[model samples]
Target: MEQGIIVTIDCETRTTREINLALREASLAQTPVRLSNPDCRHNLAVGVTTPLSVEIDGHVGYYCGGLCDGVDIRVAGDAGWGLAENLMGGRIAITGAAGSAAGATMRGGTVIVGGDAGARCGIAMKGGTLIVGGSVGVLSAFMMQKGVLIICGDAGEALGDSLYEGKIYVRGMIASLGSDAVISDLTDEDAAMLEAALGDAGIDARPEEFQKIVSGKKLYNFSTKEKEIWKTAL
Candidate 1:
């Protein structure tokens, strides 16, 4: 039962149900639908999504599309916290900006932010790819185990804390590192990955210009001096 729907944010239409109901009304039942005008709030669309293509026309609240799967999401404006958190699969794109912790602990899929992003974007990411065309705030991609975080602009402080097996790419500046993050040279494979992701996100760039951030291989056992040094290394 796939459907197509439209939603516009307002005061009376408070609940995310406004979006969901529109989808359902358009004959969507775990089906394909289109949504628009999700204002910044909380949990705009945060659960089982299927075969839907949501096109948000403005800013969105926290936890937008958190835990969504089998859907294609596109944002014409900015986003809030927990964007696509724990998403299993599918694709989400933001044309404007985002708030804190966008794509926190996401397990799979792809998220692209065209403009700047707030703090802790891609925090604890286990899998998938988070692409930001502009700067990101502090602690983005902290404790991530797998996947990739690619930023085309400047980065904030305290990134990749206790991260295990993921790759990060920043084309601009970094402010700080987390528990055991380190600066690394981008390998050929890493470059290929970056180019591929960027291409998918419709960003035109050179992979050779990007820098990769990796874990220090020492997840535990840290000294204050080392922490201080790492902090400065960012």
Candidate 2:
């Protein structure tokens, strides 16, 4: 397909390998592609490195759009585990709920989930932003190193557990905080950022309506003096 041309691939008629090949080809040419009847397939468009637009018409299974760089992908239905894992750049939008480990270990870009997300959402995320329009499950943002996780609805227990430098914002009730995670006063800069991010993601809440969670920095260096904190963190 030529660059700028809109390509449509029906996933129901092709093998996974064939579909991925077509995606890669379209990515190289910077063409916008639409995938029909994905049927919750796994590993579709795994490693396209160029900037392109892709629209997946139905639900997707594990690792969909993983390891991609600078691609704009939209999933029209629910997503399985490890959605957009290790993404290097660009954006991924999921219209429905996501399974566990969504956006796991991603280095950059944005992931927007229109519905709820399961456990360990944004786990070990290194950079960028993850915006969830609904509630997130337990241990969400666990061990997150960097980036921002915005939960427009409630958050489950141990949210932001053992986090290094990531920030979490929740608009609804938090069941319980994780070890070494502390609620901090929302700064003006934080409010501005939240406003921009939420606005961009099409989330309707104001920044002041949310609470910010950050690392207490007690786990930066383990010591016997802080043994009690270490016990839970470890």
Candidate 3:
């Protein structure tokens, strides 16, 4: 274990601003920290960059750990919208469920949800990996251009809708595939990637059970003949 300084802040007495300030100070010192009595406050620990660890003892609201880099953040309970949105690096984990747009537009690092995730999970993700140990809601991975979204359980309707180049893997049922998205045969490389991802997340799912979803590439170019069809792809 890496020995480091530790600080604890009580959210009950402090506003989110104060808590964030305290975290900033602690991170600047490269110290590990703990947050107690978090009452689902939005944007906790946003934009923190340090090689340290942060532990939230309870739930957090929207955008917890957003834009994080070079830190490890763990939430003990569920999270609201956009957890880890636009993340640049490092790792964030939710021990419970996550709300809409989890990992939205993230360019790097990893986000792991121990339970289910809501609508638009991994929306427009540019890079990195998102692992959901449970089901995902509708419109998951909508308009995703890069990266990987992995669902160990069922996926809701329009999964990967209008996706550009991102990869999606589901171990359970998919309610529907969105426009220009189709199931493809899992390759050996995909299995290796899935295994590594699940292992990194400490999830026990088997990669063989996962079905890969990728863009069909049928709508890469516009044509007058397929103008009506292109509308759905958009």
- Considering every candidate listed, which one attains the maximal lDDT? 2
User: TM-scores of all models?
Assistant: 0.83, 0.93, 0.93
Order the candidates by TM-score, highest first: 2, 3, 1
* Candidate 2, superposed: residue stretches over 4 Å from native: 1-4, 224-234
Cα lDDT of candidate 2 equals: 0.93
Q: What is the lDDT for 1 in model 2?
A: 32
Weakest ten-residue segment in model 1 by summed lDDT: 2-11
Q: Rank order by lDDT, top first?
A: 2, 3, 1
lDDT, candidate 1, residue 148? 87
TM-score of 3: 0.93
Deviation in angstroms for 55 in model 3?
A: 0.5
**1 or 2, which is superior by lDDT?**
2
After superposition, candidate 1 runs with Cα above 4 Å error: 1-14, 21-31, 220-234
Q: In model 3, what are the clashing residue pairs, if there are any?
A: none
- Clashing residue pairs found in predicted model 1: 40-60, 41-61
For model 3, residues 1-234, the per-residue Cα lDDT tens digits are 244556888999998888888888787777789999999989898988766689999999999999888779999999999999998899999999999999999998999999999999999999989999999999999889999999999999999999899899999999999999999999999999999999989999888999999999877777776887878789
